[model samples]
Target: MLSEVTATRYVTPLREGGSLPGIVEADDLGTYVMKFTGAGQGRKTLVAEVICGELGRRLGLRVPELVTMQLDPVIGLSEPDQEVQELLKASGGLNLGMDYLPGSLGFDAKAYQVSSAEAGRVVWFDALINNVDRSWRNPNLLVWGGELWLIDHGATMIWHHNWPTAQVSAAKAYNASDHALAPFGPDIASAAAALAPLVTEELLTEVAAEVPDEWLVDEPGYATTDELRRAYVEPLLARAATIHERITLDAPAEDKPSQAPGWLSERLAPRPRATKNDKDGGQ
Candidate 1:
């Protein structure tokens, strides 16, 4: 399991995220962003966060360090917001904590550009996880210390919500046309070449072990938490075997800046080179 720490204080909620995660100070003298197990999305959200976030870190993508935070209900007593207090009370046990990076900025595709290699790896990973939240409208990427970091993985692994058909769901083609990185020219083949071989059974087992046992208990079909952990591993490994081949960026040619719909063409238009005659005339 990831390092476990106890929350000492809840500072404020991050209004931007759908789950209303908050900034917290932990007893270890570190600050973290807390994802509550009691969010409307349920413990399944945190489960995805741990599984996907840890997997990305292992795959050499930048993801914040994670921990299993011990949240005490009493920490909410000082908060005036009734909703926040209720949520804290309900999430009194284990929750998810991401190491807080101070002064980080949200990703802006317009202002910044990532290399095709980086874009491909991220898009490929998102496809395998079935994350639909990385669209241009709400890119869940962060720029901290000049490198991109992935966060907000709660929306991935939708099949877990319907356990009976998870296998079938895992085989479907991913829709990444609107992915924020789509316009950046993702090199999916290279991503598969580099990361696919690393997703071994041993790696999956280690990743699954990081999920807290409490979240795995009483899952509808599983008799024990270990059984549930194995369930998480099977679908992902199966998806990884075939998903890379099916991930066609699918973004139209016009989406690329050089061929964009209207003004983009003008912005990318090539300027004529100055001739020798023109240079001599100026001289």
Candidate 2:
């Protein structure tokens, strides 16, 4: 289970996203980015965030640590933003909090060249979860401490929105043509070989079981939260088995020709070590 904490104050909303996630100060004296249950996407979005974000963490990818935050509706009284006030009041109890990474710059492929291994690993992870939001325009990736971090997994597992028709085949073909690092030609085969074996039934079961019971309640066709947890795991385990083949079969041609690669090779070719100032890329 994730660490549980009490949210002591509601700071300000991060308006960059549709769900209106906000920066919150908690009793633990740590700042967190809280994803509200009352947002338009609803509790279901938070469900995906926990499952996929934690799964990625266990798979050795960089993701912000997640915690179960206890929110009090009374805090709404002090908020001037009516929209935020209503969201807080509605999401009175348990919500999801991702540890806030301060001074992190949004990932820009042009600004920083990602190695093939890193790109491949990320692409592989995204494909397994059926995430469709890593396009070049809105990468949903952050760079902190000169390392990449994945975030905003609420958009993954869209099939869960309609439980009746959802199938293991939810792991459909992924079109990576517009992905932020598509030009790098990720080593999907190598990544799949290393990561696929790690996605065992036990791992998915543990990850799915971590969702707060409050968020899992009232889910249609399930009488208990345990059943809902199983529903989340089954499709994901099925996808893990076939992700590599699906992506390799569906991947389109790259922008640059096969012979000459662009920015990545030039940036990676042996040269003087990058200075700390250079790492910021002038954010």
RMSD for each of the candidates: 4.7, 7.3
lDDT of 1 by residue, 79-179 (tens): 99998999999998999999999999999876677888998899999998899898877889999998999999999999999999998988899877778
- Candidate 2, residue 178: CA error in Å? 1.8
For model 1, what is the alpha-carbon lDDT of residue 59? 96
Q: Which candidate number maximizes TM-score?
A: 1
Q: Which candidate has the highest lDDT of all?
A: 1
- Per-residue lDDT tens digits for candidate 2, residues 99-205, read 99999999877677777788888888999998888877788999999999999999998889988867934857766656666657688889999999999999999
Error in Å for residue 82 of model 1: 1.5
